[model samples]
Target chain A: MSTNGFGNISIMTRSMAWLIVCFLVLPITIVFAVSVTDKHYLSLPEQGISFQYYEKLFTSGPWMTSILQSFVIACASTVAAVLLGTLCAIGCWRLGNRASDFVRMLMLVPIMVPTIVYALGIYQFWIDLRLLDSYTGLIIAHIVTGLPYVVITVSTALAGFDPRLEQASLSLGASIGQTLRLVIIPNIKPGVISGAIFAFIHSWDELVLALFIAGRAVFTLPRRMWDGINESLDPTMAAVAAVLIAITVSLLCTDAYTRSRRA
Target chain B: MAGLEISNVTKKYANFRAVDDVSISIKRGEFLTLLGPSGSGKTTLLMMIAGFVQADRGDLTLNGQTITHLPPEARNLGMVFQGYALFPHLSVFDNVAFPLKVRKQSREEIATKVRAALDLVQLTALADRLPRQLSGGQQQRVALARALVFQPHLLLLDEPLSALDKKLRAELQDELKRLHRKVGLGFIYVTHDQEEALSMSDRIAVMRSGKIVEHGTPTDLYERPNTAFVADFIGKSNFVSGSVVEHRDGGFVFSGGGVRFVQRTKGPAPAIGAGVSIALRPEKIGVLRSGETAENELAGTLTEWNYLGSEFRLVVDAGPFGSFSVSVPTWQSDLAPEIGAAMKLGWSAAAGMVVAQD
Candidate 1:
């Protein structure tokens, strides 16, 4: 007698969707529960609730430094990507359709190829340039990886933009620069912000490329977290994962909120 | 405040000439409507005048200053796009105030001007709403207000009312005319609707294949179109192609399909035996009753007819002379039409105008 909210979709597919949702949430839930466990080693929440691991998260110098470094790199790279990528998208949009499409595809090179391959290529290039393991090198690499996200989102934003709005502005005595700043930019801000969010997230949890390219000179949070996991089951690791999940969820929620605001 | 002269303006796109040596002298405070079907280059010509498009070879002078190479912003023209193109994010107030803000006007000046513009369009109460929050007609008014806020020298509208429903379109048509009169700004309006052009414009330029085939007052173009295209495009006209049999002071005789048609022309008459087409408006041709008489008359069978409320549009088939549409008022007590019934169609000699074949 009940339609199960799907209206016409079969019960099998509905249950499958719920099953997938649970499957996805289970690991995060377990890590979140483990993060609060009172035990010394990593274990489930059969023990008493403890703030000890979370306390360690804030107190540890090296862990805090890694987190701070990640934040700096992510902020720097997100800024660089959003600016360059948004401008690039505007350039492509002006170039007209076919050429714009080709340029857009070209911008996606970093995203299209395997990360390890591009990372290795970038490492060789940076090593030759003597920028290896430097903040500039890591930030540049992060920007290159993040560029595609900003380009795609801004391009998508520009897609719905009525070009006549620009014409209307120009005809009403605003220069091209004024039109972009006053009209085009604000309309596409949601896209640029979402792109920034993606770029930040991309740089924040980047381990593979950072692992190959960075060492002690630039010890990022993910790089340190990866090392901690490899070395030992530090209960602090569960706490870090829980924090990472929280940060990613918040970033995604912001993206969703902005996207819905746009709609 | 300004009169713009477009002299020999032309735009070529690869193999096609989008605007071909098109020239129109838009007088100060004139409401000129460029009426044409799609691909007739009315939009292209409008774009050229607005400085959005660079003419291949021409000179555009606004108040005697050559502005052919000027960018749109430098031209200081107002334009309303087909979709209204209101900024979705900005409120009606900000949208209307954008020009003043970009020019760095004082906050007080911007508020006053924007308020006046909104009030002009009757959208003062809804100034705080975004474009999406408004209905189609409201969005249109906002676009109008935004363009008019700057008090531009000339206003260019590109099929601005095409997006609205029929009733709203008629309402805005009056609104546009009232705004033009109130502001006294020169306006260049583009539309494909003949009725809209006829009712609203001081002068209508009927374009065909990248050229202004006819440019005149709506009544002038309607009554005396110089070309077959203009006659047909400006309004419904029944064209009869033939060779001139004789040329005279009052009327010229042209014969086609075993029927000799007499047409009136004020211009230089074509020589006898020259090919030409006569354009006759449907309303001009009346039903000749039993004793009624006209300058010219033809007998034909009514093949098709449509009841157009105020009048009946009958398609009369005159054998080899071809089918002609004749509009007869329903109130007139005369020959009532029935399918396949033979009837005599008549029009004065002045009703059929001699139009160029090309």
Candidate 2:
């Protein structure tokens, strides 16, 4: 095939890129294929394709409850994370000093620290606070883990934003709050939206933090999926994995679309 | 008193003084330009006037009311930033209506005022276009409309036309002057372009080393500069440095580089033997005919020359006395310039002014 305008990308390099995509996406494709398996256990369709597992996903009490719980936790945590993270990013961007640099670095500590280690720390803290096994503890843990994603995306967006727009807004009689609402926020809207999406996905797909803090009362979808894998070998598990993959892929696609639109 | 007053403003960053004890009172409806080279604190002083940069020591008052401590939003001044700073997300109409909206104006009022402001800049047709969609000159006009829509007490423009092409810049310069007159608002324009300042401003404040070196009408500063820095910065000038040799008549004679020239001054002449520097404009010196006489004359060989459309710029290498640059108008000069040709350059006593060395 011709390299076209891609600047002499060799056939081997193009094949390697395809190879990497397959390597990354093949497992999800397998899960998707298994989701339509005819058999009750985990296996590719043999007799015929079936939608029974998918039907079970929507109809089953435990799966539906877990999905609802996960949705609520993800949404609550994403809202909290976006609020705090966007404020922190704007503050650091405007301050533009060594101290703000240190603060921004500190906000990234949750992402830098190993997730299992942080989960264990949160586990201990939640037990002392008597919040373990509750919605509040799980949401708090998810928010903490989701914050770095929000901060990183928002900060990247703020980096491209011209500071003079803020000055122009103020000089034109915009109050500080008015400037943020009318000028700064609108200009950095893509970043904020990207951050919110990432934060939501971060909380939604999170397993380790949910495993540590969540109990029967606050069972999230990821924790339930983990339990399903350990406790049972069923096509329903494949169906759930396929659904999560689809949701994540679509969210990421939306992010890419919005970002490209901005460019 | 119905204008902006900036007094004793100083801005220090670390050890560098960005603006040093600058004071200027702008009369109502005056076009005052802060003209300087880069890093000359002209922009800093303008920022202080716009309430962006806080003065370490100063009093900024608008019409007898102190506004030194006021925030930028409270200052009620419109600023057209260096690069226009138009909101990318807003349409040209919305951008012009921003200040009015910020002040919580009614929808009809904002529409009427925005339409009028856009009409003022001849951008009513582009009201729906985003800033990124418009041409450079169009964006500049939008910025002007936005700054004026709210009828700000004063308008501050920081190198507003620096981003445009030469032809467009000239067109906008005339537009800005017309807008100033029509609106009758105080305009504090900052620029490093001397021609832009000269053609547009009623008064020009020449700044250097964080201080206003001199401030006067453009003609006054160009014709009678107070310092060597102002003379060289405002326009092209040849410097003749020497000590006062004799006080003859009302003017005095100064000798430098084996050449003596008479300089006319209304002020007291520097004491005899006192070091004095004279700034002689290139256009003031002319090529003298064989029998023609001038108050000061020098004979030199034409070392180099350039034909500049309407004028011939010749570099004459006068021996002992340094080279003198003389501009001869194409219409007035009958002599053809040639390299290595000896020529007599002459200028009257009133042509040179004694300026203090910066």
Candidate 3:
């Protein structure tokens, strides 16, 4: 009788976990199915599967341009964010006082505030600075939004790092910059890489800020996808979403592999 | 004049003084140890000397040059921190070669020097292994090698062996002493372990409450500690407090626990009727047999006893003086110690020393 009770509980938990996973993954699978639909509109294929939408997504000039623009912005903003955020985390970790703690908390405000609110706030500033509709403006805006991820990850890495290594380097005749480059940086490489990946994905998928500040001259991938959904229910948008899911999944897998190897 | 000099150094954290008004001059090739219990400012003093912690009021000179305001890199001191803070990402070879690389030494010189440093620690076979891959003792040797490779003016170690097991720590203690002899550079080591300090240091400075209570050679500090704290901290001691009653030729008579006894002092004698304390070692007192006598004797009942393989330890309860712990060698004692048996503990006049109460 006791064995039956334990077995029943285990079965219930296992079924519940599987149900939750299926509920979470069902929408992504639908998007993948719609991507290969044979129809011209947004419905699933009735007769046979088709590669027409995928081919169209590749061939279309606007789609290619938007993808390129988004890639450039993500790369630029990720570099800026990693550099600024890693330094900020290191400064906070080293200072280890109330003021630095307050500043570290302030870095997370961008992530905490609603994206629409941040977009409206930055839209006003971009207009005042006359930086609207430019690559520089979009890159800077994405960098501000991407910084918190980098700060959090790098700060966690620094928490586990032995502060004595820095002292040892300095005592061995290495200057402050030399210690950071040779000892500190190499030790925290995993955190920096994880931060860069998050920052890149953030800038790649961001649409609200691009919708607010970006104009005709600088259309990003998300902005183009948003326009496609509004102008027409095109299945090519489903193909774009599938491609985005693939890229994001692959990047996340690489990050997981790196972290596991480190462990 | 050609060694490190720290004068009137102090460090305060808010309301607390971590290291206060301390000064020490280390000779060129001396192995000095800052010995104390936890929170005794030994490590803080070492950090101040290493240029990691700034002194609130002091001057630090190295080889006749004032380096009080110099950064740690410019000060040119090597430090082996607690837990052997090796870079986890770098191999042993790269870790030891770091200082040479920082100075931009020729690649050939760096390789040869790194090889020699590894060879000194006898870790040449594992040069390519990361710090995580090495055992605790091996990692300690790597930290030592890295600190010595730069050939700094002085090497400071901050409780570097506290992380190891007892047997491993004992092994490294001998290794460190041999390395100190080989290098011939001044070493300033910090630790709370008294045995480690006594066994390895040329001179030991005992610290308490951010102050150096006494500093001397190992034997001097052990045999003639000036304070009750040092006597108790360095080794096991039984403190006996009394008031001086008379002055003798080379000693004084003190009435302690309703018993008068003579205590000799090489230093100035305490005034008559002044309260005083004496630190007596347990091993110095012996079990007096029939017809045997000593300068001081206390009769009591044996309340507890233990055989420690090499010696027999007995606690005797004297009526007025409370309990006196006496240790007798197993070979010297023919009678077995039984609890509640009458015993007479005896010691010579010089076995106890006058010590100041903390």
Candidate 2 chain A weakest lDDT stretch, 10 residues: A1-10
Candidate 2 residue spans exceeding 4 A from truth: A1-4
TM per prediction:
0.95, 0.98, 0.97
**In candidate 1, residue B268 scores what lDDT?**
70
Give the lDDT ranking, best first: 3, 2, 1
Model-by-model DockQ, in order: 0.86, 0.95, 0.90
Candidate 3 residue B112 Cα shift, in angstroms, is: 0.6
**Chain A accuracy of model 2 expressed as TM-score:** 0.96
> How well does candidate 1 reproduce the true complex, by DockQ?
0.86
Q: Pull out the clashing pairs in model 2.
A: none
Candidates arranged by TM-score, highest first: 2, 3, 1
Writing each residue's lDDT as its tens digit, candidate 3 over A1-263 gives 56656555677798899899999999898999999999889988889999899999999999999999999999999999999999999999989999999999999999999999999999999999999999999999999999999999999989889898999999999999999999998988889889999999999999999999996999999999999999999999999999999999999998898788778
At residue A179, what lDDT does model 1 achieve?
A: 89
lDDT tens digits by residue: candidate 2, A148-191: 98999999999999999999999999999999999999889899
